[model samples]
Target: MNERSPVRICILALPETSASVVYGMYDMFMSAGRDWGLIVEGTPGRAPIAPLVVSRHGGAFIAGNNVRITADAPLDACDDADVVCVPELLVPPGEPLAGRFDDEIACLRRCHAKGKILATACSGAILLAEAGLLDGLDATTHWAYCDFMSRQYPSIRVRAHRALVASGDGERLIMAGGGTSWLDLALYLIARLAGIETAMQTARINLVDWHDVGQQPFARLARTRQAEDAVIARCQSWIAEHYAQPSPVGAMMQMSGLPERSFKRRFQQATGMSPLAYVHTLRLEEAKQMLETDRQPIEAIANEVGYEDAGFFSRLFRRKVSLTPAQYRRRFGAMRDAIGCISETR
Candidate 1:
């Protein structure tokens, strides 16, 4: 709380926690306060935050990938920190959290009651949800786990589409978009607590780039759980290969050798989408890939994906991707091309 004293950051280390995230945050924050001066021409001042790794039981423990790290202190031993950061826990979605993290949950609840801003990255939101801190608040996690988290915690308003969400009074809680975007949380916490200059210096020092697109663009719609029905499997495979061809649904129905009604029922049961919608999803995914990787014109991409009407394709692309094809290209493709050019020159 004191401007002159370092902001105390307590990072909780749980079983199966991502070692990269834990060490990454610790290193980045330390570098911000300790190494910024060495890297920059004119040093301002020492970094503001003092970070410590704390566990439920303080000691050396193995993280998700068997990377062992020792805690500076146990949660019970540590004082209330300025910020309590929850790193990505590699727990499966929809698993019960009561037995595994009851103590951690209690600690978090007490911390929140005392008004410590609780932040979670990726699946670490699981801990916050388990603690019931996120109820009635907008939150997000790894896009793959968004639906699972939403279904498990119906009271929490989950926004899998956004990159980061900070809610509650004084924004005491923050949820970064899942995965590597946790760096966004790091940058934000620095700016909020340490000042913008420190945050910018940290970003520049770490080469952390802001991701413009949300998780929606990267979702693989067709990568859903497939049904056990062998007929439906074949139908799905055929559709994946021939989605650009006209009359795919009709062809699939005939291939199934079932009555139209039977084929439709089985297909829907298998993929959780209508046959026509599946074709559209396939086409849209292909279109997105081309838009991100190729220089083809929008109309050409549309036709290649089986849309004769580029206007219709544009509308569908927007509806599904939340970005027009050209917008997607500009957002993803141009950056990728620029990165490629840089790499080639290097």
Candidate 2:
């Protein structure tokens, strides 16, 4: 940050916002052009990016995880900030936010209209979509919300595979994918506003790695939440415990005590998926766990998860999970072992 003055960044804090994302961005932003100097040299450099958390109505509030959060200023009073960020909002997909965050949404639009670079970590992109600022631009959010955002806001092109996206008028609107991909977002912002050298230094100091695989591999193909319909719920519970059995979907249909057409329609209505799709989801999820934790033969594992043909299973796994079964095992198994090694060292 060779700029004469600090980069002013205002983080828009909202209800149910994750405390970690908000404060983590704040810390990283404040550290940019500052922390590296402190660690390498005896003297501390002046912070390059000045960050403040501003809420719609400035004050103290509880976050989604019951942690207390305090805003630095009100949104209306934050016109001077060069960058405005929306931290991860603990919003569930498919939940309507029609009457909520009206003030915050309007403020975001005004800031972007005034040429302020707007960014969001994870689910916070929902606000940008609601504000209509991302229309005609490529955008992304948490994997869980990608489909919902696309269905709800058809104008914006939702890129579900990318972990980070930057698109809008002049590419001022940026977003990061689920969870700690915010680290990547912050580093990119630092590089954009400060310098690439500073961003690289910050990444090295924080030991942050990029999520190169994107979000598709982490996304589940089908919903697992219980359905509102009692019959569908019973069928789901049955299938959960018997997904490996042959004709699992048929067994569920029989257990549901409904005619074939009625059962399929009702199951689709209740779960947003067909019966066979739901069964496939259950089987794949179980197979993923086995791949991550065990060294069993792929054929045996496939058989155990209700797939008789290993070739068919491999193709299905690749199609649904964006990774071959063997690839998934190598990736997750190595990840698990790395975590264990890190834990042991600690």
Candidate 3:
């Protein structure tokens, strides 16, 4: 995108959307063309973007924070946006969206059909999925909603571990995961549409960290639910206690009092994982915790998590976590210490 013309950014404002996201997006885009050079030097630069908040109704709408905000224009009236951004939507945890926000979905479909670049933050990706825009495309949302989106819309490939994912034709679809990631989306959109120098300038002015590790570190791994199966529930509870025991799957099978064939079938149906796979996951989770918090040696941590060989555990950790145990400790341990320092000061 050239800087010759101002890029029009239309931020969709809905009743369920986060108020901070809408305002922050507008501020970031508007500051990009002007704030960077002023912060670096004394130069006043020309604004490169024209951002406007558009709503279904032209009247004032209340956001998640109970703040009332009036839109710059209605969605129907604003049909010439170069980029359309869908901010984080307020929804209850683990609630199925069902028939909610159908009108917004339709409007987004229209925007995409008009060749406008589409972007989503947090649960807003649900709107894109509902609009049939993400079908057969690789998309991501907040890690919490990843499984829900994948189960609801089976055709779309969900990358739960990515902080941001760009897919589809010409990579028109941009998605950022969970809360506060809309800021990352803003910086990226500026860089893509404006220039890297412009994005860096904006970052410097705002004191924002531009690079973020993907969603893997923040993901909730113990999210497995036993689907109303008593046998599987019992097995899971037993595994929780004896995950470090040798032959955990065998012990679970015997404790379940079900035949091997029936046990495997029921386990898969309830947990969506094989019995052995579940055991390995439990061990890995325990190892991850030890790596993050404790100062134990890697070999001792491996033994605690039921792995006799440290080399094998290290390989497995790298494969699943994209970081070695030592590396994970070095990064997250320092982060935890920094947070502790802030807490102490407070």
User: Per-model C-alpha lDDT, please?
Assistant: 0.84, 0.87, 0.84
**What lDDT is reached at residue 7 by model 1?**
85
lDDT of 3 by residue, 129-233 (tens): 889999999999987677668777889999876778898888999999987788889999999988898898888888887436776665555545545799789
Show where candidate 2 strays beyond 4 Å.
154-156, 220-224, 228-279, 334-346
TM-scores for the candidates: 0.79, 0.82, 0.88
> How many clashes in each candidate?
1, 0, 0
Candidate 3: residue 56 lDDT (0-100): 85
What TM-score does prediction 2 earn? Answer: 0.82
247-345 in candidate 1: lDDT tens per residue? 999999999999999999988766657899889988998888899899999999999999999999999988777788889999889888999999999
Ranking by TM-score: 3, 2, 1
What's the distance in Å from true for residue 158, model 3? 1.7
lDDT of candidate 2 over 164-271, digit per residue (tens): 999977789999988888998999999999889989888888998878777767876444667889999988878888988999888888898899999999998777
